[model samples]
Target: MSTRHVLLGLLASGPSHGYDLKRRHDEQFPEARPLAYGQVYTTLQRLVRDGLAEVDGTGSDGGPERTAYRATEEGTRELSRWAGEITPPAPFVTNEIFAKVVVSILSGGDPAAYLRAQRAAHMGRMRELTAVKSAAGAGLATVLSADYALNHLDADLRWMTTTEDRLTTLTAEVDAA
Candidate 1:
């Protein structure tokens, strides 16, 4: 989900300073999706420019005064429309392992070496994902987020393993021929 939508959703609940928004984003967004201060500020600026949030108050944040933001009527309307229209979907990350392996094969590099690296990577991912799910089941994951992460991880692991198996089978058959 866009930071715009998340900030607006937070504002819908209550007015908050930018730092608070940042904290909540850390909680909600995955670690891979780590947002920097610049991105948050930039997105907030866009929201302000689009007539979504307005400065309501200013306060100290451990040192300096930070402007608090609240949703404007137009902002609320936009946020609401966005919320209804935008059901957050899982992020789509391109699989470089297969692509790179293909490139290596075409370039006459050792397929086994590349595939070995890919195997390690995918296996490591599976183990990590399994650990995450276990931690979630044990109620140890951050923000009780194991379930959402687990579901996706399972999907990914399944796909990775299946793809690897199919590729290996194809390679073996072709080599035999």
Candidate 2:
């Protein structure tokens, strides 16, 4: 995830402190891993330094002072440009599952067994995500996030099935190489 751009997008909504930004990010991107407080602060500082954001204000209500940030004009322009660009559809497959499968074949390990285990794990996750998506009163964001994850998992499961079928050929090819 482009943390910098995400932070800028949050700032574009309005001024917000690090804590608020982190909370909003978590709420907005339910499928994404929660952002760390330190990461938010560090990204904010970098955005300010790069002229993408500015310190809007600092205030305290009988608590520690909170510095609020707002996206600068340049930041707005950058955000617009980024939002308009199309994200590349995973141009490369560098996933760990594929790596481990190849390594297993090379090392004379049971790639078939590994693939079976991995497939089981993926199926388990898909079930969990399905429940999440089917839950009553699940917000649109949560459902959408679950859908996104489910689709990716589905694709992975299909690939694993195909790879398992071709394992003999793959093993021979790996041995030759």
Candidate 3:
């Protein structure tokens, strides 16, 4: 996920201080890993440097003065373009699992055993995610995130099954190469 775009979207609501942006981000993306304060400030600085955001003003909120930021016209246009664009699926050909399987075979190890281990690991993770989803209650963000992960794990399990079925042919092809 693009932190830049996320901040831009938040700023679209209104000008906000760095601390406020961090709070809003956590509220909006409950399932996401928490953002560090330094990361928030760094992203804001980059946005300001790139002309995507500007420091609107500074305010004293009973402590140190906090600078408020607002999105620039260009930033809004960029955010719109990003929102409309479809992200391509990640290439599975270069995945670490595939590499590990091939390496195990080349080194005269049991690729099938490796695959079985991986499948077990995936299944364990799926169970954990399922529990999380169930406990998420009605939080759409948490449920959706868990669902997304579960779907990906399901696809990976399917791929592992297919690969195991074709291991003989794959080994032959690799040996030939």
Top-TM-score candidate index: 3
C-alpha TM-score for every candidate: 0.53, 0.61, 0.75
- In model 3, how large is the Cα lDDT of residue 58? 99
User: By descending TM-score, how would the candidates be arranged?
Assistant: 3, 2, 1
Prediction 2 TM-score vs. true = 0.61
lDDT of 3 by residue, 22-140 (tens): 99999999879988999999999999999999999999979999999999999999899998999987744788888999998898899999999999999999999889889836488
Predicted candidate 2 versus true structure: per-residue lDDT over 1-177, tens digit per residue:
799999999888789999999999999998798999999989999999999999999999788999999999999999999999999998998999999999999899999999999999999999999999899999998999899999999999999999999999998898888
Off by over 4 Å in 2: 17-23, 30-37, 57-68, 91-96, 109-154
Q: Please give the clash total of every predicted structure, in order.
A: 0, 0, 0
Tens digit of per-residue lDDT, candidate 1, span 1-177: 567888888888888877788888788765657668888788888888988888888878588889888999998898778777855464765667657756555665666666666667756876776676666336555425655665665665676567566766656565565
**Candidate 3 weakest ten by summed lDDT:** 89-98
Better of 1 and 2 by TM-score: 2
Cand. 3 TM to true fold: 0.75
Q: Predict model 1's lDDT versus the native.
A: 0.73
- Lowest summed-lDDT stretch of 10 residues in model 1? 135-144
